[model samples]
Target chain A: MSTIGYKDWNVDLADVGAIYPFQGWEVAMTIVGVIFWLGWHIFQVKRESAHLEKAKQLGDHDKVHQTLERY
Target chain B: MEGNLNALTTVFTEFYYWVTVVFMFLIHVGFCMYEVAASRSRNHMHTLMKNVMIIPLVTVTFFFFGWWIYWAFPMFPFFGGLDLEAGAANLPWAETMGTNSSDRITGVFWAAFLLFSWTAASIVSGAVIERIRSSALWVHAVLIGSVFWIIDAAWGWHYGGWMVKYLGYHDAYASGVIHAIAGGYALGVIMVLGPRIGKFAPDGTPRDIPPHNPWLLAIGIFLIYTGFWGFYAACNVPIIAPEVIGGQITGITWTATNIYLAPTTLSAITFNFLMSLSGGLMAAYLVSKGDAFWTFSGGLAGIITASAGNDLYHPIQAMLVGAVGVVIVYKLHFWVEKKFKLDDAVGAVAVHGYSGVVGLIIAGFLLWGAPSSPFEGYATITPWGQAVGAVIMFFVLGFLPGWGVSKLQSKLGVLRIPEEVELQGLDYAEHHAYEDAKAEIIEADKAHLAARAT
Candidate 1:
C-alpha cells in the first residue's frame, strides 16, 4: 500500500531501485505535466492579449508617454 | 584525531554544514527585506530592525540553552528522563561547544542549527510587523528561536526523538518541526497582539494591506527560495555509510540520508524541489489571477508542502502536492483572516504553518507504511500518526506556549505598542531622536542657504 513501494528499509540497499511515490504512473504524470505546460502558454497568451487591449483603450496619452520615457 | 578517512569525513561534514549555514543566512536577509517592504514607510526602519535583531538575540540565547535542549530533551518527560549524558557535551561550558580539535563537527553543526533558529523567529517577526513592540517581539523571538521550536526539534528532528520512535513522525525537512511550529507561534501571537489599526473595516471586513514595495518583497522571497535550497541540503547528512548508521541497512554503499538516517539523495530532492516550485508558481498564478505577492508566496508554500516527502516523492507528486497545497493554503488564509478577524501581515501563518500541517498529513498518506527511520523498532509512517503529529506541532508546541506567553505579555501591557505610538508609527515614536536630528540638520542647511543669499 506504500506509495513509494517499500514498506520498510530492511532490504539491502543494493537491491533497491526507484523509491518515489506512484511507481507505475510515470506516463500519466507526464501527460498531466504536458497539459499544465501547454495550458499555461494558452492562458498566458489570452491574459497578455486582454491586458494589451485594455491598455489600448486607455486615454491617458501623456501618462503613457511619461511611462515610456521612464522605461 | 582519528583514522585518516574518518578524520576527512568529519572535517568534510563540518565544512559542508558551515557552507549551508552561510547560505541559510540569506533567509534572515530575505526576512528583513520582506518585513520592511510589507510595512508602511513610517514603520519601515522599525520593521527592519525588529527582524535584524533576532539574529543576535536568538544566537546568544541558542548558544546558552537551545543546542543543549536539542541533545538532552529528545525523549524527555513523556518517554524518558533528560539525556544528561548527551546534554553534557553540548552545554555552553562543554569542550565540544568550543574550538576543541577533538570535536571538529560541533561548532559548524551548532551554527547550522542556530541559523534554523533565526528562521523560526524571523517567521513570527514578519507576521507581527508594524504593531508589535521591539522589546516584546525580541522576547517572543527568544522563546520561539531558543526555547519552544528547539524542544519540538528535540522531540521530532533528533535521531532519538520520541515522535520518531513512538509515532513514526517523519518530517525529513522540518515541515512540522520548523515551519508549522513557527507559523502557529505567529498565529498565536497575532491573535493576542491584534492587527494593525486599519487592517479591518468598521464592519470587520478584512482589507488587503499590500506590501509598500512589491519589488523588494519579490527580491526578499527570491532570497528565501535560495536559502531554502541550502536548508534542504542542511537537513541531510551529505554522506554516510551503512555501517556508520548501525541500522537495518547492510551494505558497503555510501549515500546521503535525511535527518533520521534514512537513505535519500540530493539528486532526488533537487528534482522534487524545482518541480514543486514550478507547480506552486503556476497554481498560485491561476488561483490568485496573477497576484504578484500570492504568486511569489505560492512558490514558497509549494516547497514547504512537498518538503516532508521530497526525500521519497516523485517529482510529479511533489509538483501536484505543491499545487494542491497552495490552493488550499490560499483559501484558508482568507477564510481564517475573515472568520477570525486575524491579520497576518505577510501570510506567514498560512504559507509556513498551514502548509506544514498539510504537507505532514499528505506525507502520511503518500508514504504510508514506509519506514520512518533506518533503525529497527521504529513505528511505520501512518496517516493517523502524521495527523496527530501535525496537531502537536501546530497546536501544542507552536500555538499553546505562544498564546500563553503572549497573553501574559498583553496583561502586563508590554506585548503591543501603545495606541498613541501605533497611530504615530513605531519608527517616529521609538526613534524620535533620529528624526529630531535629521530635522535639525535639514533646518541648519536651509538657514545656511538663507544666510549665504543675504
Candidate 2:
C-alpha cells in the first residue's frame, strides 16, 4: 500500500500525472487554500486599522519634523 | 518519456525558463533599491521592507493558488467555465507542484510566472510609499500580484486564453497582462488612498517630489534594464515541435516560438529590446529636459510600450514606437496629476499603465492584418480589437476591481492612514519603539560616563 498508487519507478513516465501525495484530495485542498487567501486580506486590513490608530498617537512633534526633514 | 530528441527538448526548455527566472529576480532587487532611494531617510527602512516583503508574500500565495488560476481561469467567465482538467494537477497540494521526477517543467514554468507576480506587486509598491500602511500595501501587493494579474494572464497572455482566441489579443510580452494591470491598480488605490501631504500646494498646483537619492534610483533602473533582457527571453517558448503544438506550420525545423506557438527568435527580440530601451532613454532625456529620474524611467517605459509588438516589429520601428510613447506618457503623467489631484509617487501609473495601454493600441495598428494566433480561423490583429483589449486591461481587469475593493476599505476607514498618522509618517509607527529603547540606553551611558569622570 503506497501513499501514491504505485511505489515503484518501473512504471512508464507518460502514465504518471501527479506524483506528490494525497492524490484525490485536490478539490478539498483548493477550498482550504481559497479560504486562506481571502481570510488573509480580511485579517490584514483589520490589523492595519488597529496599528494606524496607535500610530496616530505615537510620534511627537520633533520626530515628525525629523521624518519631514528626510524628504 | 518519448524519444531522445523529445527528452533533450524538454530539458532545454526547462533550463531556459529556470535561467530566465534568475535574471527576472534582479528586477525585484532593483525595485527595492529604487524605492528605498526614492523614499525619504526616516521612511527608508520601512519603504525597503514594504518592497522586500512582496517576494515571500507573492511567492507563497502564487505557489498556493496563483499558478492554478492561470490554467483554470483561461476562458472561465466569458468563454466557458474553469478548465478543471488542466487546473487539477496545478493545485497547490498536487504532487506535481512539488518535487516529482515525472514532471520536469511545471516547477520552472511556475517560477517564471511567479517572477511576473513579483513585478506586478513591485510596480504597485513604488507608487504608494511614505504614506500607505505596510499592511494595507501588502494586501494590494498580494491582490495584484497573486490574484488580479494572473487572471489577466489567463485571459490575455495564455496560449488558449479567450482574449487571444476571440479578441485576437496579441500582447506577446505582457504589455497589458502584467505592466498595465499593475499600473491601473496602483492608480485606483492611490485615488482612494489620497496624496501624500505636501505633495501639492493649497492652490492644487502639484509640486515635484524628487527622489531623495537620485543616484541610487538611477542604478536601480539600470539593474531593471538588465533584468528586462531576461524578462523578454522568458516570454518565448525556446523550442517545440509542430506535432506538440498541434499547429499548421509545415516545418521540421525546431524554432523558438512566442507564448502562442507562433514563430519568433531570441535574436529578433534582442535587437528590439536594446533599440526600444535606447529610444525610451533618448526621448526621456529630451522630454524631461535632462531630469534624471524621468529619463531613467523612460528607458523602462519605452520597453514596456514597445513590448506588445517587439516580437514582430523591425528594430527601428520598436525604437521609434517606444520613443513616441514615452513623450506622450511623460506629458500625460503630469497633466493627469494636476487635473485629478492624484499623487503617484514613482510614475507607476504613467510608465507602466499608460505605456501599456498605448503599446497595445500601437501594436494593433502596426501589426494589423497579422494573424493573432497560429491556430486556424482566429481573428487577426486590428485597431478595434486592441482598443477593446486595452479597455479590458486598464479598466475592467485593472481599474474597476481595484477601485471597488479600495472603496470598500475606504468606507471602512481602512484605506488611507488617518490625518494625524499621515502627518507623523508611517515610519514612526515602527521607529518610536526604537527611540524609547535608545533613550533608556543613553541614560545608562550618561551615568557610566559620570562615574568614570569622578
Which predicted model would earn the best DockQ? 1
Name the regions of candidate 1 deviating beyond 4 angstroms: A44-71, B429-432, B439-454
- Chain A TM-score per model, please list them: 0.87, 0.82
lDDT of 2 by residue, B124-172 (tens): 8999898887788888889999899999899889879898888889899
DockQ of 2: 0.01
**lDDT of candidate 1 over B125-151, digit per residue (tens):** 999998898999999999999999999
DockQ, each predicted model: 0.64, 0.01
Q: Model 1 over residues A1-71: C-alpha lDDT tens digits?
A: 67778777777788888988788889998898888778978988898889789878867889889989998
TM-score of chain A of 2: 0.82
The top-ranked prediction according to TM-score is 1
Task: Give lDDT: candidate 1, residue B424.
Answer: 88
- Candidate with top lDDT is 1
Which 10 successive residues of model 1 chain B have the least lDDT summed?
Answer: B426-435
Q: For every model in order, what is the iRMS? A: 1.4, 21.3
